[model samples]
Target: MAVLVGVGMLVAARPPVDVLGSFGSLLQTFLPWSGVGVLVLLALAALRRSAVTAVAVLVPAVVWCSLFGGMLVDKRGAGAAGGDLTVVSHNVHDGNPDPAGTARSLTASGAQVIALEELSPRTAPAYERALAESHPYHSVQGTVGLWSTYPLRDVRPLAIMPWTRALRATADTPKGPLAVYTAHLASVRVSLAKGFNTARRNEAAVALAAAVRAEPLDRVVVVGDFNGTTDDSALAPVTAGLRSAQEEAGAGFGFSWPASFPVTRIDQILVKGVTAVSAWTLPRTASDHLPVAATLRW
Candidate 1:
């Protein structure tokens, strides 16, 4: 049984198909937690004094480390101390009771660019007013928005969803013109009857990925609620060429959902033609999702 469990862990490390109705994607989402199973098996082996079982458990332990060992290292100093630009992304819950307060927290991050998702008609105004002073230039397309300290141009909506849920624009930073994309991908759900339901999110990812591929700018930054983790193969289309800021420079897993007690990161900051010097999650706000911030160097 221990050997079989170890083998299963190794198999799961490979990209899996969604033939079992999104099971593969779901598994990948929490794949890191598989290490817990190996630990449990080791405990059982000790209780039984079974040397073979203990040795078998080492298989999965090594596999898990090989897959994620680099992340365990402290990489905050991988890039320069003051990056060229600082960006933040958050999913302020649509029903959040205090949009003003949430906006305040984001401003305190000192990010040059901030992307917000799940903005409702009523709460969006509060955010605009609160963030106006710090982020003078801003654009809100449907539920997604981008607020920037730098000037914005060529702002337009992205047709990734039926209604507006994504947008892109050019930020004339001191470093140069950078193409910025903010998107709120379709939410995913899981159930016993339908298994993990990510069809909608997957479709949105495909469309977003297409636009990103066609972007003319050499320097690009994508920030928003991706609704799926980087580990999930479903996001491969969008994450293919780009690199995740958190994965490159964050201290840990950097989970950012369910702000009360984050378990997984759905919100993301991905970059192309830029380097992430530092990436970290901000303190919880009125919103259900925590904000993720990263500093990038050109």
Candidate 2:
């Protein structure tokens, strides 16, 4: 059991999947609580007067907590006085039964810029119409879209697929041109032979990273359901230059998936050359993933 838990921890820390990207996000949803389980086992062993078992349990508990405790800190700091923009991101589950409700909830978030992924053909029009009133400038490509309060310029599609995959839009904000990229990377599904497959996700990540690296804009924001975690090796190429808004400003772990019982934050907002003042996970809605909001100062 100890060895199994240790292995699980390692897998949770670094998802072990191929072709798809769901494993890491799945593991992150459950791994943080494993330490508590270890502690419980240690207590039970101690109660049974099994000294050896107790020691084994205690050691792993301490080690695990020591390794990841800092991540539990309320990283979201108080909002700065001069934040230039506020952004929100969500997957909005393609099969969401309540598009109007989701739109209402998002509208209440008061985000100046909204990035959405998993936008199905049937629901995209509803979202576009719903947000049209406040976000006059908007752009969509494939399943990804960006709605901005400011004027959008040079809107284009990102190369995440053999065809159009993601969307990129530049907002002409008062501070400067803010380049926004929205993507719903390849979804990972379980298979018989492989525990997790992330090939397509890895390919998309590489392509996205290359595009971002070649971007001419000084300020950039990337948002969407990455289907991977900040710690996942597959995401290293993108995380190398950008800072996670939740990691910088959120309090505690910002889990945003499986809305009914969120365990991982595959939905993310990453920024470059901007200060994240505050970040937080919003309340549950009709979608499978919860929304994430962040304030940024230039």
Candidate 3:
């Protein structure tokens, strides 16, 4: 049992989709306490004179914590001292009835740049109109859009799929050109035969990563409902080079899904060639997912 748990914990520390990612989100609320639990279990086994069990449990506990302990720290650092940008990302569930209210709440967040996904044709116009007053410069392609206070240029739809799957726009900020990507990767649904159906999501991630890599801009921000965690191996193509704003500056795990009772952070704000001073999840609104905001500096 100790060996099994040890192996499981090791595997879990690796990435999402493994037995660990599949369950870690559920256990993260008590991650620090879970560490204590592992220690206690090891102690009990030793007290019971089970040396092998004790070692097995103790060894894995130490390894797992050492590997991901930084993630448990509440950095909450100031946005890059010279940071010049504020960005927000959210998946405004296409079927949401309170599109106007949702738009109001997002605009109130005071985000200088906003990237949204899962936009429906019916609601897109409303969101565009609502955001226009604040973000005068914006671009939309397919179901994704980027609203910015800075001038937008080189707007293009990322061919993440043979069909459109993401949007990319370059914001000519005073500092320089910042490439912004808004993508709603294919959602993964679980099944007995497929376990976690991630083929489509993986494909989209690869395509987006390739597009970002090929862009001419030095500063890039990618945001939206990735439908998978940064820990997921399928997102390695993107995660490998970019930094998650929440992980860099957030006060906690920053979960943002199932807004009523968020358990995982599928929404993300990833950046490269810029500093993330702070990152946080916004209050719940009419949508099923909470918005994620980040403050950054060049």
Clashes of each: 0, 14, 4
User: What is the per-residue lDDT of model 3 for residues 13-130, given as tens digits with 9 covering 90 to 100?
Assistant: 4535554443443343223334655777777887899877766786668766775577778876755343688899988888988888887888787788988888888888988888
lDDT per residue as tens, model 1, 139-230: 99999999999999999999999999999999999999999999999989877888779999999999999999999999999999988899
Ranking of models by TM-score: 1, 2, 3
Model 3 spans > 4 angstroms off: 15-57, 79-82
Best by lDDT: 1
Q: TM-score for every candidate vs. truth?
A: 0.96, 0.87, 0.85
Off by over 4 Å in 2: 1-30, 49-58, 80-82
